[model samples]
Target: MLKHPDTTNAATSKLAATFASQQQAARAQPYPDYRSRLHALTQLEQQFKQQLNALAAALSEDFGHRCAEESLRIELLPTLQGLAYQQRKLKRWMKPEKRHTSWLFQPASNFIQYQPKGVVGIMVPWNYPVFLTLGPLMAALAAGNRVMLKLSEDTPATNQCLQHLLAAVFPDEQVAVFSGDAKQAADFAALPFDHLLFTGSTAVGRKVMQAAAANLTPVTLELGGKSPAIIAADANLAVSAERLIFGKCANAGQTCVAPDYLWVDAQIEPALIHAMKGAFTRLYPASRLQQDYSWLCTERQRLRMRTLLQQAEQAGATIISCAEHSWQHYLNDGSGLLPLQLVLNLPEDHALWQQEIFGPILPIRSFSTIEHIFTELSTQARPLALYVFSDDKALQQRFLKHSHSGGVCLNDCLMQVAQDDLPFGGIGASGIGAYHGKEGFHTFSHAKAVHSKGWWHPGKLIYPPYNKNWLNTALRWLLRR
Candidate 1:
C-alpha cells in the first residue's frame, strides 16, 4: 500500500540533515584528484560485481517473475560496460582542456578546469532500477561529487538490495539512498543540491523540475514519450519484425524506449503484421510464456494497462493477443501477467494513442508514404528514441536528417543505448539533458574557464578612457577583424 509522503518537520529535517552532511563532506574534499576519482569508481565496480547475482534475484522477486537471465543481460551487462568505459577514459577527461586564446591576449594561457558540482541527487524509476541508478550515480562520483539517491517505492525488494549494496561500499557522506512514497519523493526533489537527475514519466518529471526550481538546481530529466518505430517500404519484413519484437517484448514493454506505436507502409501492413505475430509467437510460445516472460510489476499497473486495452476496444480498436488464452485470461486472475497485445484501428482520440503505452501493448499504424510520418511527428511530443528500419540508404538518411529524437537506431532497436560512447538523453518534451561517457562526466562537473597573464599589461592599455588617438587607432584596427 502506498501512502502520501510525510512532509512533516521531522521528515523534512532528516532529509535536509542528510543533504547538509553530504555538502559538508564535499567541502572537506573540495576536489578529488584523478587518482582518487579512479579509485572511487573502481570501488564501485568491484562492489557491484560482488553483488550482481543478488541484485538479479531481488529484481525478479520484485516483479513477481522477472527472468533472472533477462535481468543479467539487460540490466547488469550495460552497466558494467559503462563503468569500465568511465575508468578507461577518466584520466584524460579530468585534464584541463587547452583552449585557443585571442590575439589581444597572446602569450597567455587559457583553459577550463572541470570542477565537481558538490552534491548531486538522483531519482530512479521502477523499471531498470539498477541501470538508471548506477548509470547516473557513477557519473556523479566520477566527476567527484557526493551523491544522494531516491529509489522508486514501486520496487521495495530491489531497492532494499541495492541500498544495502551501496551502503556496504560507500559511507553516507559519499553516497546515500532514500525511500518514500510519491509525496516524499517530492520533498526529496525540493532539497538543495548542486545537480539533480530524474528518470521516470514525463508527468512526474515536470513536478520534479518545479520542486528543484525553488533551489535553482540544475537537472537532467530522462522522461518517457511514445517512441515510434518507422518501417520503411524497403525494410525486410522478417528482419524488421524480429528486431522490433525483441525490443518491444523485452521487459514486457515497460522500457522507456520501447516502441509505443509502429508506422508501417500500408501496402505491406498485412504481411508485416503476419511476420510480427509469427516472430512474437516464436520468441514467446504460449506454453512457456508465463514461465519465461515477466509480469507487470504490480496489480495496479497491470490493471492500468488492461484498462487502456479495454478502453481502446470500447472505442472500436481491434486487438490481436498472442499467448495462452490471449489477453482476456488475465482479467479475472490474480496474476498481472499479460502477453503481447497488438492493437489496430484504435480511435484517434483514444488514450492508447495519446499516452506512452509502457506495457506489452503496441499500436500499429500503416502509412501510405514515408513523408506522412514527418507530418505526424512534427505535431506530437518529441520522443526519447526513434527506430527506422530501412534497407534503402536514401530513406535511412532522410530520417536521420528530418526527424527529431533523443537518439536514433538504424536497422536496430534498443542497441543505441548499449554504446558506452554515445550520449543518451531526450529533447523537447522527451527530456532536458544528456549523460553518457564524456558527456556524463561534464554534466556533473562545472567547466570553469581560466585565463592567465604573465605580467603583461597590454589589456590595461584598452581599459582606460578612449580619449587618446593611439587607443582609438588600436580599437579601430582590432574591430576591423
Candidate 2:
C-alpha cells in the first residue's frame, strides 16, 4: 500500500531535522579518531552476531520461504567479514597520504586528507536487504560519517529486526532507519544529503539520480542490467556449467550480478546444456522444493517471470525445465516457486531477450565466432558483470580487452563481489561509482588536497614582475608545458 502524502511529508521533515543535527555533530568533531571508528565497527559486529538467527528468520518471513542457511552464507557472513576488514585497515586508511611536489616547488609539500562526507543516505533494496543496507553503512561509518538508511517497504519483517538491532547500539543522531512505501522513498530521495547510495533496478535508478541532482548530492547507484556469461570454444563445458548454474540458481537468480544470459560456441551448446542439467539435479534433486531454493520475493515478480516465459514460448522459443517434476505442482500450492529454465533461440525482439531476467530463467544463445558475441553484446547497455570460462589465456585476454563491464570474473561467477579488496560497482547503465574496502572508504570521503609552502620559497620570483630577467626565465620555464 502507498503512504499518504501528509505522512510522507511529516517523515521527511523529521528526517531533515535529524540530518541537520548530524551535520552539526560532524562540525563539532570533523574527523573521528581511529579508536572511535574501531569501537563503532566493533559494536556493530557484536550486534550483528547477536542477531544473526533473528535476521535470518526475518528474511525468511519476508521472502515467504527464504532459506536461513542461504541468508547466513550470502548476506550475514560477507557483512561480518567486511566489517572486520574495515576495522583492521581503518588506521592506515585514516592516515593522510603524502604526495610529491614538482622540482620547481622545492621545500613545499602536498598531501591528501580523507575527510568524511556528512550525513550519508543509504536507500536499501528488498533483495538481500540486510547485506545492501549494512554494506554501505559499513563504508559510511568507516569513513566517520553519519548515516540515514531508508529500508525497503517490501521487507517489513526484516526492517523491524534491523531497526531493533541498530537502535540498541547507536543513537538516532548517529544512525537512523526509516521505513515506508514508494511515496516515502521519493520523499527520502529528495533530502539534501551529503551523499546518497541506492541499489535497485535501472529504471528507478534514473529517478533517484534526478532527485539527488536537485540538491547537487553525490550519488552511488548500484543498478542491475543483463549481465552475460560467455563460454569459449576451448572451455570445459562441465566446469563452466557448474559455476554458472550456481550463480544463477542462488537466491533463485534474483541476484543483480547473476548471469542473465549465456553465449556459447555452437558446437558445444548441447554439451553445456546437458552438463547444466546434470549439475542442477545433483545440487537440488527436488528443484524448487529443495530447502535452500528461494522463491520469487513477491507475487508480482512471479507473474512477470511467467509472462516473459509465456511470451518466449509463444515466439517459438524452446523452453527446457531443469526440475524433476512439473512446475505447476509448486505453483498450485501458492508457493510462488519458479523452475530454473533454459530458454533457447529467443527472438531478438522478445521480452525475454530484451529485459533483465531477475528470475531463474537462463537465455542461451549460440555463437559461431568471438566477433559475433561482441556484436550482440554491443547492442545492449554495459552490464554490471561479465563471466568468461576459458583455460586459454589468449582467448581470455581477447575478451577482456574487447568488452566493457563493471567487473569481470574468469572461470567463476559472482565471487568477484565477495573480494573485499576490489571495488564493486557498475559502468554505464549498470551503476554509477563504486564502494568496497578502500574504494568504499574513499567513495564516502572527500579527498581534500593540502599544499604547504615555506616563506623562503621560489614562488616570490614569479609574482607579477614583468621586468626582471629571472622572472622572465621562470615564466618561460613554467609555460613550456
Candidate 3:
C-alpha cells in the first residue's frame, strides 16, 4: 500500500512540535542549570537501553525476518557499546585542556573549554535507524544540548516504533523524533539546528548539506560510495576471499563500507573468483531464507538490483549467482527477488562497474599493477572505506599511504567501522565529519578557548611602540628564546 505523504509529514511535525516548544521555554529560562539537565542522563541511560530492545523487537516484526536478532547484534549492540564507552570517558573528555602561557604573563592561565551547540538535528537513514539515531543522540545529550531527530521515511514502521519508544522516556522539549517523508525531512534539515548530522546516499547528502548551509549550520555527513577492494597477487587468496565475502554479505550488502568493486591482479583473477565462489556457497548453503543470506529490503530495491545485473550482463560481464534458497523462497512466494550475483570481467563502462552497487552483486575489474589500479581508483570519488589484501608489508604500507579514503583495512574488510575506539567517517565526496567514540563527542561539541590574565599584564610593552631600542630588545629576546 502506498503511504499518504501527508500522514508522514504530519507525524514528523507532531513529534517536532514538542522540541519547538522546549526551545521557546529554554530561551526564557536562559541557561537553565545543567546539573539537573545532566542528572537526567543517568535515568536516560537505562530507559534508552530498554527502549532500544523494544524497538529492536518491533523492527523484527515489521521486517518479517530475524530482525530482532540482527537488530540486537548489529544496531542496538553497537549503540549501547558507544554509550557505555562514552559514559566511562565522559568525565575525562569533559576535563579542561590546559595551554602554555607566555613568559611575560607569569601568573596567568590559559585553557580550552568544550561547550554544546544549543540544539542538534540528526537526520537518520533507514538502514540501522536505531543505531544511527542513538549514536548521535548520545553525543548531543552528553554535550548538554537538546536534540531533534528526523527519522527516515523508508522505514516507517521502525520510525513509528522509535517515536513511541522515545516519547515514553523523554518529553518533546528534551528529545523528540520526527517521522517524515522526503519533504518533511528537508524541512527538518532547514530548521536552524545549531548542528546537523545526516546519514544517507551521496546525492541526498548534497541536498542536506545545501539546506543546512541556508542556516549556516555546521553539518556532519555520512554518505555512501563505491568502495573498492584490491586483491594482490601475493595475497592469501583464501583468507582474503573469506573476509571480503563476510563484509559484502553482512547486512545483505546494505552497508556503505561493503566492497563495491574488486581489483584483482590479472594473473590471480580467476583463482580469487573461484575462492570467493566457494566461500559464498559454503557460508550460505541454498536451503534457507532465514539464514546468512537475506532478501533485499523491498521489491523496489530488488528490481533495481535486477536492472543493474542485467545491465552488467548486457555489457558482456559473466554473472555467477550465489546459490541461496532465499531466491527460491521468494520465487515460490511469487515475489520479485534478485540473486546475490558475482560479476566477472566487467568493463569500466558498465553501470555495475561505474556506480556503487549497493546490493548483493560484486564486480571484479582486473589490473596489471598497483599503479594501474590506483590510477583507475583515483578517477572515482573517494570511498567511505577501502580494503586492500596484500601479504607484502611494504606494499600494504604503500597502498595505505597512496590512497585517500574514509577508512582502510590492511588485509580485511568492513570491520573497521565496528571498532568504537576508531573514528568513522568519509573523506571528500564520501562523507564530511567523523563520529564514533571520542570522535563523535568532538564532532558535536565546539571548543572555546579561555584565558585568565591580570589587567595589569601588558600596558608598557606596546605603549612606546615607536622606540627602536625597545622594539629591538623585545624582538631579540623573543627570537632568541
TM-score of candidate 2 versus the correct structure, residues matched by position: 0.97
- TM-score for each prediction? 0.97, 0.97, 0.90
Worst 10 residues of 2 by lDDT: 324-333
In Å, residue 453's CA in model 3 sits off its true spot by 1.1
Clashes of each: 1, 0, 0
Candidate 2 overall lDDT versus native: 0.90
Q: Which residue window of length 10 is worst by lDDT in model 1?
A: 2-11
Cα distance off (Å), candidate 1, residue 431: 0.7
Q: Candidate 3 residues 1-481, lDDT tens each? A: 5568777656666756765776775566433344544455555667777777668656654444434666677777787777777677677767778999987765789998877767788999866777888888887777767788888766777787778767777777878787756777777887878889999999999999999999899999999899999899999999998889888886678778899988899999889888987887776666543543444666667677767866776888777766644333444464433446788877767888667788788887788868987786678789999998998998888878887899998888877887888999999999999988788878877888998978667636656556768667887898897
Descending-TM-score candidate ranking: 2, 1, 3
Error of 2 at 407 (Å): 0.4
